[model samples]
Target: MFASDRLELAERYTELLATEGVVRGLIGPREAPRLWERHVLNSAVLAEAIPDGVSVCDIGTGAGLPGLVLAIARPDLSVTLVEPLLRRTTFLDEVVAELGLAHVTVVRGRAEDLHGKATFDVVTSRAVAPLERLLGWSMPLVAPTGATIAMKGQSIHEEITQARRFLSTWRCGEPEVLVVGADVVDPPTTLVRVPWADPKRIGWPLARDAKRRSGRRDRSSVKREVS
Candidate 1:
């Protein structure tokens, strides 16, 4: 839900999505009529799952679904919208400027581009990819104490099952399926939260890559030698 002070900004964004968004093929024309209930409000509801005052990265954020919407709803959050498409980033940048959302940053790149360079309290996505692939793209950007929270549909359980091997290899804690915005959105929103099993030992592959870069043996070989 948007604060009273920010409600007008949200409305402006919705209008843009309905007009410019549809004209540019970002949003289908059919979706324009229901942009409020189906897109804007639905995305705004995601705020309930996010913590206060956190750095968030929304990857593959086409037209900045939950990312831009969150910025409008929660000024306390620092949001980064990551999209590879120049067109999408263009629209996103324009909206940010028009809305005067100082807290938002638009990054024109894929989720993998920022893997080693940055990390945030939350890495999020909507209709970006399946759970298996999403983990690869999202988890690396997640800070040690943070998580990858993605909006999912009814097929989430199947996706989770498919991602079991990835979950284990990445050493992620059990994925928690949560329903947020129950009172706000009629159908509500389903989210899957994936955190590191042990914050102190997160980023297994990144650690290995770092060891290689430093010309050092990986933990496994080092442990074997000590044994």
Candidate 2:
């Protein structure tokens, strides 16, 4: 559907939220503000960056923003919403079941313990923590060929730099700021975050490459991944 007009997808997404009630029920408490634009689209924006026919995990997937939405949008991509909070996990499971979304799994656990338990082609995270700390959680859960992406705002440049030390420790790939697509036709919004993880920091250089390309498509990276 993304290959088609994105506006149609946005309309469907609007209806998807209104009828399903996952985003509001899971997030947007009476105390919290700015639910729709901040959390929903922020999470959904990842849908554009994710490759087809891959497995993705959302660490601290509180209400299953990008994770669940992407799952609904791309059935071919297997998605796992990993939320340590029991209430959130229960809410996520119920949402998946009610929505009848396929290839979407709910894993109730933390990133630290998930090591050796399972891995994924990609990992999406937001509101988790700093870049380096997020790396510890995300890197352990991704396949060697996959990468970990954090949804960030404000300080993309500093986060990338701070993530450098941890990237060295994890030997993860490079961290880059990609884009988060919006429903509007405005200049493509940037994911402005990091995509990293791999052995000996092979993903190291990918950080800059992804930044330079702004998450559109990296022929060299894809070619290397195939070889």
Candidate 3:
């Protein structure tokens, strides 16, 4: 937290991962250091896209990347990090407390189970799942005119291309991509937004799995997200 630049902050994030032994427990020892570049920096890129005063919900916020990082970077917005794992959820709660972050809430539950009571200005998550599923679980939480920013790597273009079917069917708006942190993040990234959709979309990423099993849902199934 005391680090000045992204370079140092990334180092600090790595140091904390090792010190906290979170690397060993959550992502395994081999992958922890890489998290500095892969996760933290990747998540931080969303900071620039965030609008002021927006209350955001980050689904599957394992280590509170986009959500926690966004909250730290933008004090004007409120961030809610949703993670079901108890230990991870506690870790986020503790980190927020330690950082003295004034605007963060770590919720423990599967994304599909939590109904945000229709109270978020923005919804954000990183590779939490396929676009179709992620939208289903996330779109409902978005404010009527609110947006969902789905973070994906450079190959996101492929998913974005394929996701149009769902976007159009759901009546969700256009998609967007951003290439910030070009040097620090791999495959670069994109921030996709679905402007307005059915008020309560449930069973998103979760449904993707089920759809696969029955083959009942596919590119065409993307439409039914409303109410």
Q: TM-score each candidate.
A: 0.90, 0.71, 0.75
lDDT (Cα, tens digit) per residue for candidate 2, span 1-227: 34443445444544545544444475434413444455455556577778888877788877676677677667677676777777677767776776666566776767665554455678888767777777767766666566777677667678778767776664655566775575632333455433444343443332222322112133123222322
Quote the positional error of residue 97 for candidate 3 in Å: 1.1
RMSD of 3: 9.7
The reply for model 1, stretches above 4 Å from the true place, is 207-227
TM-score of model 3 (CA atoms): 0.75
Q: Best TM-score goes to which candidate?
A: 1
Q: What is the clash count for each candidate, in the order shown?
A: 0, 11, 2
The deviation in Å at residue 95 for candidate 3 is 0.9
Model 1 per-residue lDDT at 211:
24
| Ranking, lDDT, top scorer first | 1, 3, 2
The lDDT, on a scale of 0 to 1, for candidate 2 is: 0.60
Structure candidate 1, residue pairs in collision:
none
Give each model's whole-structure lDDT: 0.83, 0.60, 0.65
Candidate 1, residues 31-105, lDDT tens digits: the string is 999999988888898898999988888988999898999889998887888888888999998999999987787
> Which digits, one per residue and each the tens of the lDDT, describe model 3 over residues 28-135?
677675766666667777866778777787999887767877776666776777787888877776777876765666677766655433336788998798787888
Alpha carbon deviation, residue 166, candidate 2 (Å) = 1.6
- Cα deviation at 123, candidate 2, in Å, is 0.6
